[model samples]
Target chain A: MISLDIDKPRAGARVVVAMSGGVDSAVTAALVAEAGYDAVGVTLQLYDDGAASARKGACCAGQDIYDARRVADALGIPHYVLDYRTRFRESVMEPFAEAYVAGETPIPCVACNRTVKFRDLLGLARDLGADALATGHYVRRLPGPDGPELHRAVDADRDQSYFLFATSRDQLDYLRFPLGGMTKDAVRREAERRALPVAAKPDSQDICFVPNGGYARAVERLRPGAAEPGDIVDLDGRRLGGHDGTIAFTVGQRRGLKVGGTGEPLYVIRTEPEARRVVVGPRAALARSEIALGGLNWLAGAEPPCRPTPVQARIRSARPPAPATLHASADGTATVALDTPEHGVAPGQACVLYDGERVLGGGWIRRAVRP
Target chain B: MSARVYLDYNASAPVWPEAADAVDEAMRAGANASSIHAPGRAARARIEDARESVARLVGADPAGIVFTGGGTEANNQAIRCSGAERVLVSAIEHESVLSADEKAEILPVDPEGVVDPEALDRALAGDARSALVAVMLANNETGVIQPVARVAEIARRRGARVHCDAVQAAGKIPVDAASLGADSYALSAHKIGGPQGVGALVLRDPDAAGRLIHGGGQERGRRAGTENVAGVVGFGRAAGIVGERLEEFARLSALRDAMEAELHAVDPEAWTVGDRAPRLPNTSMTVMPGCESAAQVIAMDLDGIAVSAGSACSSGRIRLPYVLEAMGVDEAAAMCALRVSLGWWTTPDEIDRFVASWADLRRRTARRVA
Candidate 1:
């Protein structure tokens, strides 16, 4: 096993592992214990399964809590299950629904990482006298010339740096990612070698609060009457059909248009939530050459670059990074100029700036400009 | 195993050595009390002896003691056994009694968490239907002792039966069922340093207290299933010792008072719950402005001090305790509530360490908020 670089002596360094009852986190906890560090497992009960319907493929439920406790017992470590329902509901779930209501497709996981996991749970770890907080995130935190730096994982396909772009520099210093340098297969093998009970547990998919991928249902509950009927119109301003809710459609979406026979394929260009209208057009309309960003969070020392800097930007979690020039305005707003026109640049999705493999900064997309 | 000091006795007290020995002895005997053999007779004898000891602690007759699985079961049995069409329970009663009847009337309490006697009289007069009144002798969270005799008098005039949940008050205070005028009183073993999983419902009239678990004629057909001999032995031993240690346990109030005084000295805004009423000497619920209970608990636990929040959700996140909320504490102060309950084994050094740690936390929280 590769040795951990925690600050204190291995025998007494208290390490708190954010266990999610998954194989990855369980293995991370076992690795911490095996490295001769005192490992304390903590799992956040982020939502009430009764309040929000339990999704089959989602995690962090009652069963997951039980599984985490069993693993903690097997490892002979102290474990605590903290109730984070109110925090999660306010910070992640509520904002997610409101974002949809505002006609923006928000990434709840990014918001969760920014607020619940890093901010709240990190504070809890500090309160518990833990030297460092470790998670199963497949992202690397390596020591740089100045301090710790966030980078893409060795398993490039499973890299989660996009969702973690908003992690502040101070938090990065106290965070550890044990699965950062290993492949999923190797992690599974390590879980098997360590005899973890959740070794055979399936990977969680789907938004946890949205049961069975019922995003619209959750949104309706959060913002009552959010799914009001709207007009599905084309770029020419002719109504092709009547639809239900602007939140049901996102930019560049197809398949559920319900507008029959337009002679050519039409994609959602944008959703106007105020007017309660969804505008569809040819796929070319979805391409954007520039995007304005807001709520900028920079992972830099002292100050962020005020001048335009050339970097690669990822507009979506699954999309590859695109070459872009980030122009930082004095008033805290930023504009990204894509070297080549990128497609489906939507508002509310993160524009994460990358310098090769290192995450420089990120901001929420405010507007996509078609030039 | 470490040098951690446990101050959350209201949650569960540490098991005493004598109780452990009794449990071990009974477990070794391994006899069913229902059987007619010599071993079964020995088990029966132990169970009856435990019953007598438990009764003696609460000033009830041995024949009136009916053992149940736990305190919750005892309370449940008493509440359900009262064959009344309606139930009137104190708003501050434990969940076991509060949830016993779906439509149970809630009697309001004052700022000190004491049930108002006039409200019971008024409520009883308003409702001509036969009702069962349930009120806890002492609250688990704030340790405020309630007036059972007054409630009993009001209920007696109105032809209602009264059930007093003495789970928290039995060993900590002078609990005599005859003086309290409670038709039924509940007792738990674990709260007084016995093993868990054993408690008794002491009744004034056994016939009126209907059987909750009916199978074999155990506890004179009040509660059934073969007796938990080991658990009963531990409960009896713990109960017998608890009465003798009342004077000893009374000294915990000094430690509790010192801690509270130190807390107020650190943060003048720090407030104590149920300070105006008669309360159990060991418990103190202190609220510090702007410092959340969950964070305080974690910080104290890190410092090798064990305590609990006044009100916690199922996920263990601290919420405003309903008792405090009912007493009209604001959301901000309620969220900041911390409960520290001392017990027989809590030491002065431990109390000092806890107070220092708490003062440190208050300073840190004050700094962070600033």
Candidate 2:
């Protein structure tokens, strides 16, 4: 467990805090300032979608940037809004669409962190001649002999290490997570204690660029001709019905199928992009024992053992990490065998590996295998 | 600080040394301008002298200059005083004019943001009673000078008064109220090289029935309350200095043209707004397609040069440039509008620095897409 020395102040060190116009980031910046660092708040203008960002409460967009500027003004620190819309489109939005088209569910938050938040922002911090890049993420960084080590937050319910497995060692060295040692309640309490304007603001649930939770609609807007009508089929290759597009369907989605009752609830089992078809079955067919992972970024410097290394794997962000054994291949891919069968293992979903609270790494799920 | 390049002069300019000195001199006085004592008369003399200087700058009688807190208050007072059952304004006027009320009719601008005198003629010709024609002398976004004379003639023929928000035009160009035929003209101090918190409303006739702020008799009771003595002194000094530096502004205009040429060479799609119409000498608004203005501003800021997306007042909130959109530019092109304004303090080296920094930013941003 990592412990924070709250009483000791780290004086004179220049830290760049990423203020996203939320209570957590605001409190984190206030704490950093209170801790006696030369804190400079930076907000990234991720997109110029005009009213969409304001309506969705997206960080570093439209009105949120104003809130960040106000917080910085109140704190008497220099604030800046860095534009990252191009990077966001290339890194996060494109990959999200490609993943959906590949018949897998994708987690854009990981891509945002890896591309925009960490890489480009860290480069900006370096340009500003700051010592470290700080954020309000609910994850901790402990100073190790070799470098800073990443761990989950003190609040297990709010631990975000799973989404941060793609962070590189270089990025981690210049990173500081100010809210790591505090629970969500404690952070909120401190925000209230400091009288931050966003103390009671609700956390954002939907992806920032995708307004109204319409990811398929956003993709359609971005790529107008790609979303074509396709066929819905069963595992036995029997045609069921017509689908709008394979990208609109993900594993385990039930609603919007438009298929009448088969007396049993149908769940999406798989999607085939080549055939432009979605395969559905009963609830029993959704269970999977093994998942193939790709695009693996290992944060621990070396790959895990090939002979089913025992670890805890979190298939989704909200779910708890279940016991699993990961088998690494000679290629940069791994097969995770859950100790207990897990349901709704989507192909594009991320499989994050953790040892207790420390994040080992994670990769995108390529395919789920039945026992 | 690597020879600081200031391109956001439209936001708030550096106080001219003459203005700063005048402000310092005015603050040393020991009496309020409103008192009946000798010291008060001395302060009053200073206030009247500043008023004359401001009137001379805008070609108005000294009696017409009614001082207010600043440009915003000046605009608010002028726009609210149109005393009409219905208010009509150009679509490209500043937010101070646009945010008045729902009853205010926003007159549309053509593709070049030129308010069609015929349109105003039609609107005024239709509404005979209680109609106020409000159009800015120059747009804050594109710096395109409107045909206020034509608008005023058209309004007068229909028995309506014209109010021109000339805050962006007053010191940048040759502003003569008599020639423009505007009933009321608004001027702010800080848009030029003067102090903030002081401005003036030049009325065609001081006896016009309108009082935005009522208090202790000040500005001949047209605007009430104590005068911002130091700020007024600074404004007067700035107006006098700008009168002398008008030629310098022309020189800056040439530099602005050069900058535009370089930018267009880099991207032929780069277009300037109101290039065909009359505009402020030192103002140029360029549209860089597929590039966000806020991003360019940020990139320029990181490079230690200051620029803006449109107006600095609304920079933090990303919004479409309403003026450009009104001019028939699509929303996508409007988002890419970047306003780079030069001032008396802008040096040729500073312009060169901006060009180099912009080139670097363009290359770096281009790489990200590739």
Candidate 3:
């Protein structure tokens, strides 16, 4: 029986599965339908697939939509594709461009999951009279003493808990993640077992809207002339070299600096967008012991402004969570004191707080504190 | 669990049982229309019979009727093969017409969703000699009827060719190509309870233009490719059935009005777009205040009803509500509106069910947000 921690039994309970034209979501839908639930598959058209693929002529349905429709037909479940272009451009794409211009390393996927996917799509699922909204994300929701708790996936390497730290408690209560307990390989096998069409499909990589992996090009197109000419400077403000623009660089980056012959291997310290300057230094100058965060979402159900508490802090999705002390404030902000110095922490990244595999909650990085 | 009530007739209506039987019989008796054998001659006769029926539906010369793949191809052929240097279409035309030529000029509309006649006149004053003016008889989103006769008069008086896309209004209303004074017009079959993948374009001079497809001598050299004998037969049968019962649309309009009134009674803030304008009898664009149209559509579908939104196509792609936006409706309000189109198969019980379920949804979502 696939109760899914939902209030109702598996039979006749409606579940809306967010299908992304991928294998993981396909398996998720397969599992729900096999358990005798009325599963409805919903795919969001986040961008103009026609423009992205440059397909010409009278065709409106894209290949991704076609694939999703095929999977739905194979699974014998009803499917829908909702247009979210305007919503996505407003909530995710615009913020991504502005954050890049402000010299921050923005995580667009996180913004997508937090706003359009979780907040808006969840509302649609509820309106559709669905008992719950399920996704293929590798995160778990277990019944805790207080209520449902957001925890890490069973497969640590494929865990996506970092990107979903901004989910509110109310949203989580109506959500289900079926792939959290399985590894990627096991997911592929399960998909094959269920005879899913996308079982052999490769995983999607990089940013979805950014074509050809061209970040600077995408930013320049979004905000014309965003990559203005600027000067490269050392920590002491000594001019090193002239560059095309700061949009092409991020904190802790070593490539494309053009100042390769500096004594030790040079790393980007930070970008001053207002000054049109790129600051570079040795690797040691990039170390930060404290980080400030804003727009906090706390799932621990505890009020803020509490005393500094010990927890694991993850600054980037690529890095593992590290030992740290969390000092939360009442005004949707928090500061994390790392027990050991970490390198290359950038603004606009998330500092997710975790307590041994359980996600307490997290916020966006505002600035790195110098120790 | 219950019988599904399909209200998305504008997308594609349920095929009539007679048309289905015609198609099934045609498939059993297989022969190419182009062949010279007795079976082939029988197939050719069937196609000619279909052509006459399609021609009568639009009051066109039977010889001027040209069959194509579907409404989209008919539209592309009208605008692109009309031998006009400049193409101008209304802002509310279907995607097929609007995207036919990248440089085609777009004419605007008023808040009532009608094309501005004065604006059309001013636009064609200088280049009407080389222009092809295209407008839809009715909008697919709001079902607002355009002043096609007036537009055709302006375009023809100024020496410009006129084209009309009657895809949405053909079977629902009385449509005669000559009455509207259009040089050419295109319409679909499935919209009138016919088979998909088939449509016809009524041309003023069929022999003067035929460049859309060019491999075969079928369709009187106006279009190319072997004839879909079964599809054409089904279309002819459906057209005959739709033509005899155009009077029933008045009753559908009454049902639609009653449902809208009941819906407004439940939620006073809801909007009925283009209600004050001359519109199709069975089409309604209902806007639920503070609710997303996608959500409303999904909710209704779960309750065994089918509706739509301009923002989401039948194929499930998310599109901008450009039709409503062209009428000065804000994007926020436009996204909150859904399209409900009734057809020949709609029942009074279905309308009652829709009203009841829609009211239940309003009650469910009426809570205030923080």
Candidate 4:
């Protein structure tokens, strides 16, 4: 009974549903079809099957593509699988490896959504003459005074707005999210009600492209000889121990330092990739009052205020939005000062801003400054 | 405008009416060809009749026909069973032939996709040991005909066996196994309006046929398992009708040319591959300067016209045409290439519609790029 807010009449409008071989997407397609709109399912084969595992660079794993085709067959909709391996490798995978090699903890999913999903796949949907592209992302798009506004999902636990912070206004206009208001349980129940075969499929875990949760191995493969042996040092530049590589550590990591003699558990304060050194210190050194952001995307109706503005910001997917002050600049850069010092702030992680539940846009973290 | 216009005949031609009827009859008879009862004899008789029809179409002896699962299996059986110490294959062959022998030395091709005759001679001359020199009668992507007769002569002089995969050339042109002088030749049904799962590997000496499947005594012990009776019957029927239609197929070159000319008129940079070489009249692989073939294919498909960017493989992904690349086409033009092949049923109106839609798509892409 969900209505897609498209211009054409429901029966005449064409909606291209991006099926990711998951139960959520399968249910989204079924629901779109049940709503009397013409639905077409498309699955992107993002990586070469020979080089990827389920958790590795394959967004649409071979089995997942088959599952999506089966779901499309059950739904009686035309389905096509486009090969996007080249685009994904260039846009998502290469940048991801580069970010890690530069000693930053990167969120590849957000970049993937920004470039491959919304940008490329949305263009393909338009090329196919579809009115809009629908996905299973648990983020709501609400009609605002000016245009469609991106918002957090009704199910706070499953909200994916943090990953979709880079969706441009043009792309937002042509995208629809049907599961934005529904809970995960309700989606699984709907799948069961529709008799979809993937109803019992487990949720995809970790990064989709890191095989067996081995992100370090994935990075090493992408960048050969990137993990050279380096020095693990303390806050005063005293060598505590030797480590395999600076890439093996991230900001705020506390375990596996191998420096057992340190009185308190030493956490990684920062990593200097060029120097090949990981600087460790006491836990308090991990907290940062402000972080500079680059590649800022503004989703607010108006231009970003040049003056410092009060807002809630989320630095990572798991953390809730916190009180922060945003200072926008002429160049595409901004700095956010949190009301309370935040921990584990690392470069390359996204800093998404919000006004209550509505996303005002975000950017990649450039640097985290200690108080 | 919404009615689908299919122009990808080189990928798989539409099944002919008679072939369809033969398949339906075979399926309805419900008698296994291996059984010994009267109904089984009737099924066997149908298969034998089809074998003769296919043999006559290709100018080969009926006794040499060994039907396999499809074209890939046929090519594999021919090369794997040749008992040769080494393999020499052309760079422009279908994946079925190129991937058959992993260690096979690849013979290079010219700019028009024709195999270098001198290269083959050198390969055969250098390796005195007996080898299987495999080459296709025609390139699948570019439709460029190969000098199979001369290459086979060189191989024969050097005591190397030759295999001509005539899957793309058999029905498109005159394919005479004896004239080509190949020890073994492969043919597929689907490329010539027959059922998809049936193909034949014709051997000059029947005793040389190698068995890839070894279960049943079917295919005269040359292949195993029960015959795909319906598929074989359809292939036979398709072969029986294709001979008389060869002249008509040759005339389709005009349609393909007109389509190319119209494309050139729309985009001055449009160029055709293998135009200087003796190619199949039905195929035209054209490249427009700035248009990506994948985008063109999608745009054409949306307009209800079916074409392909390269050889349509099992994965349904459009790869840069290795055939074009081997022919010395640069990556930019290769990425922009689209293969628009015509068939016996392809009408003039369909070609016009495709040209119009393609020109519009080109303009749209150009504007977007600007």
Candidate 5:
């Protein structure tokens, strides 16, 4: 049986595979069915970008849904497309826009994985009589002493544990990630072996709702006039240049500043959305060794450790985890003290703490303080 | 797979053996009806015979029937190309009819799922341009039969035309387009025991039916594409055979009534939409307490039974059927709505099995919630 840690007999167990029309999830569905379990593929229509949808002038399903259905048909599994546009807007898109308008560079993917894809889908899976819900995420749910533990995927390069730290313990128990151990090449090869049509399909990049990675346009559409003209100031608060919209710039962003007269390359130290000021300075100003976090999902246990917990802290999705000490409180908040100074520790980004490969807990970066 | 009970006939009835045989025969010896050859003449005769059967089913003359791609096309033909400058469709109409034009003024419906003739009267009052009023004979979601006759009368009094979408009502109940006092009625064969992709527009003046699609002299210029000959024959065969089994619908209605009663017994709060109003005999749109329609449908499918809710979403997403919303049902209750529509072949034992499974599901759900 394609093994999941669900507490049911594999022969008759029904698993709802959240198919994303990507090669990884397609293989996950195939593996579950091969293991003698009833696998049902469910693809959520998260967004309807008219061009990608099966159009008839309604809240339509995008091309991803069609791809998922085709994969399900090939694997001989029952498939369902769920309309989640409203839920997605409420849980992920709205907060993301609000964050941008508040002068923060938000990682909406973490918001999605923690809310719509896990919290709500877990409820739906149980309601559908599924023993467990499986997804294509490249994170592992390992059996722990107390319960299931979220861990990094075996193929470190494809690991998504950094973005999945907000998954609660109970949610981790009900969730299964079958592609956690497989590399990108291995998953594509498996898809080819299973005769999946998406074997050669390219990986989806950037924010999903941001078509063609045009974040500025997406933000403008979601929050109109978010790109209003603003003043670019140095660390001393002297106006250096005028720019359009605080939404276009991010903390520690090097390019697109458009204030070329400065002799040395300048990085965005911070953005004051209320004042409509873009603070530019030397790259050193972006450094931070102390980080305050909020909304922690402490997966190791019911409560945070009383003493400081040594861990590896990851401040961004693209960055590697660095050595740090976590001081978590009972109020769903924490402080990650990095051993060495880290650069570009921006607010609204996820701060994931890891013990080796195991994800201990994580929270959203509320503020970053320089050493 | 075990023996399954298909309770989603309103979605599309199981094609009858007679219809299948007719479709097969027509496909085997395919020919263009416009040709002068013997094979062509034979095909034309078959099409005409099918048209007569469809006309008889709707109580219209054969000349009033114009075959189209499907019920959607027929609806578009009746609602869009009617030469009316203003179109007003009922709020609870099928998406195909509702999407004909975005500028269409919506006519309201009462709590009983009936279109308000008074509201239609108000909307049509003092309209300078010619107008068309489109309302369904029976809603596909709630199975509530609208007062299309009263609506037609209101339209006539206001010097406007009326079009009836009788796709869901024709087989489940007796439907006569001529008696409904409408300018045209849209019908689909698949809603009965016929094949998909075949439907007809029955108009008071058949010559007015082909305005949506323009081409050759086919369908008397009401429709101009090459005919779906096999589909047409199947539709006719199903229509001809269904008339003999009208009494079976009465029996199925009894089964449906018992099923709803069993549902209420399972969960006291559960209720069927439009229970006090006239509805299709085969359909029972029940609200399963504390459950969403999508979850209920998926669970039922897993239990080897087929039921449905929501409209025809080719994309397969489950959205709350707007019919109940139009009837002023709250969003929560609307999400809980489930439609169980029986086919002519549905047996009493199958109904019992459905009830048993439903009771088990309800118990499990209630226990979980508690």
Candidate 6:
């Protein structure tokens, strides 16, 4: 039986806390320091922007590092700024742009957490001789029969397990999520209790790379000639109108269609980048009963059941995980059949599966099929 | 390591032997310069002698120089003293200047970071009655020297005082306070082989009253508290050495030229900031397309070379150089710029090592991207 001690841990257990200059991470670092861990805060310098650096609310770049350093100084811990621009661009931004150009709605936060935060940052922590790598991600880890099992946060509203399903078991071993048990409000309260500088700092909503909420613009910047003008076609293959680029539209999107329909709202069912066309249809056509996933990574020791294994799958981060049956293939692919058809299941999105609260790993949705 | 090639001179250079010796001598004296006794008088003489040396190096009257903790403090003191209700500063000014006032208007620069004199004149001519103009003599990022004299003349005609943060320019160039004709000038000792914590702010008028630190009567009642005697002595010694070796050290300009040419050869689109403008001979700010400055700095460090992205004071903070932004370079390209500044200790072998390291880094970066 595991001992549960509510008291704060003793001080001076060397740990490296990844402080992203956000309220969550700032509070995490402060709590770790208060708990008697020799917490050394590190902020990844991911990009350069002179004007943006001087401006408020720009983190993960120059000014953010300064803010992190300031917080570290206030907390009386050693702070370091690591330059992870190349790694972040390759592992997060580049892939995000490429996926969009390939007619998919890519979620960059998953890639960032997987590659840059987990892999590269963990390697740095090891080099620094840190015992553990801590972040402010709201996910819990509990000792299970096999090893440490990843669990959903107690605060269901802010649980980030969906974005972190790709984290390997080995990576999880060295990781610590300090804000797992607390609600967002509690975290904010703790931040205020510690008198942390970013106590009421607003949460970052848009993609970090696409700072201006223009993911399409970021794609166009990366691949200048890739997003050519395309056609907005109906499900019957009739070109209804023209679109500047098929890359701008995502699966199940309803905005910017500019296609006049018979009063009923038309939604995007598909985006064909190769043909530069967006296929629009009725909202009912957006529902998908089954989704094929590729590049599957199962957090469990073995592959999920070759036959249907009952689980809960969430196609996107915001959506709740719906009851589904996951069928694993021999070649590391999986098919997830939802009990109730879900809407707007897009390719290139992560299909994270959960068994109760335990994250069972996930994969990118390759294709969504209607019943 | 092969002598640890020190390309981070802009961060802080090694204390010149003379400066170190002076510091040691002052430390040995063990007397407070403020005391009225004989020992105090002796210490006071040493402090004054050092002050004279520092003043001479920057072509300012000794009485006009007020020693401070360092460049940052000096910049803050000088900029905050401009006594203007509204401050007009070049976008490329150091963080000290940039953060002095949130409401300060930032004057734009061209692609080469040359501040348009007409733009300054127009800004000063506006409704800002108590506006103070602040522009650095040389940008810490690109080493791109601004047309301070032109800007100063414009500010003077408009009855505005000009403050130049000459920390990067003092030792690297022939800095004459009288020539620039700015109301106040800021310089850091460490940027010129002096002690890390000692710097001086020179006011064109000795009686210009603006005090950031208010306490005891020191620095001619302009600044407060006791002086850092050892550090001030080191600054004096370094300043004297810099003044004597000005012409000889200017030869580092050739090394900078060679490095710029080699970098451009490797990537034709790779740009050197202020290439056409007059700049510090030892500074090179190069932008390689698709290469991040922070990554290149890391790669250089792995190769046993120490370089900086822009100003070491603001190195880890990822931001485009304000100078570049004012020049209208897009944010993406600006983010990829790396600044390599040479110093008195730099040798040809080190420059060659840098070239080879950069070439290897380019190949590795390309491979990784592919």
Per TM-score, the best of the predicted structures is 5
Instruction: Encode model 3's per-residue lDDT on B125-244: one tens digit a residue.
Output: 976359899999999989999999999999988888888999988878998888899988888999899999999888877675647888888887888899999999989898888888
Clashing pairs in 5: A1-A35, A2-A35, A228-A245, B210-B222
B234 in model 5: Cα distance from truth in Å? 1.5
What's the number of clashes in each of the models? 0, 0, 1, 1, 4, 8
- lDDT values, one for every candidate: 0.87, 0.81, 0.88, 0.89, 0.88, 0.84
- Which window of 10 residues has the lowest lDDT sum in candidate 5 chain A? A52-61
C-alpha RMSD over true interface residues, each candidate = 4.5, 6.0, 2.8, 4.2, 1.7, 6.8
The TM-scores of chain A alone, one per candidate, are 0.95, 0.91, 0.96, 0.96, 0.97, 0.93
* Residues B1-370, model 1: lDDT tens digits: 3599999999889998999999999999998998899999999999989999999999998888999998889999988877888899998888788777778989999988899999988888867788889989999999998989989988998999999999998888888898889899888999999999999999987666787898998888899999999999999999999899898888888888888998999899999998889889999999988877877887787677889996344445455477888787887888788999999998989888898898988877676567
- Superposition TM-score, candidate 4 onto the true structure: 0.94
Native-referenced Cα lDDT, model 2 = 0.81
lDDT comparison, 1 vs 2, better candidate: 1
Off by over 4 Å in 4: A49-61, B30-37
DockQ scores of all models, one per candidate:
0.37, 0.09, 0.54, 0.39, 0.63, 0.08
Model 4 Cα lDDT, one tens digit per residue, B1-370: 4679999998999999999999999999978898999889999999999999999988999999999999999999998877889999999988888778888899999998899989989877766688989989988888889999999999888888899999999988988888999998899999999999999999899778878999989988999998899999999999988888999999999988888888888888889998999999898889978767776787787678999987875646566578888888998999889998889899999998999888888776666557
User: Candidate 6 — what's its lDDT?
Assistant: 0.84
Range of the 10 consecutive residues with the lowest summed lDDT in candidate 6 chain B:
B312-321
lDDT of 6 by residue, A161-241 (tens): 998988998988788888887899998998888788887778877787677788788888888987799898899999999
Question: Which 10 consecutive residues of model 4 chain A have the lowest summed lDDT?
Answer: A51-60
lDDT of 4 by residue, A175-211 (tens): 9999999999999999999889899999998788786
Return whichever of 1 and 4 wins on lDDT.
Answer: 4
Docking class of 6: incorrect
The CAPRI-style docking tier of model 5 reads: medium
What is the C-alpha local distance difference test score of candidate 1?
Answer: 0.87
Scored by TM against the true chain B, the candidates give 0.97, 0.96, 0.97, 0.98, 0.98, 0.96
Docking class of 3: medium
Candidate 1 stretches with Cα past 4 Å from truth are A1-6, A50-61, B310-320
Q: How close is candidate 6 to the true structure, as a TM-score?
A: 0.63
Please give, for residues A1-371, the per-residue lDDT of candidate 5 as tens digits.
35897667786788999999888898999999888788988888888776755555665666788899999999888998877788899999999999999988899998998899987777778877788999998988888899889889988888999888888888888899998978988889999987898888889888889989777788898988788898999999999998888888888998998888878999999999999999999988888999999998889988989799899999998899999999988888889999988888999999998999899989999988778
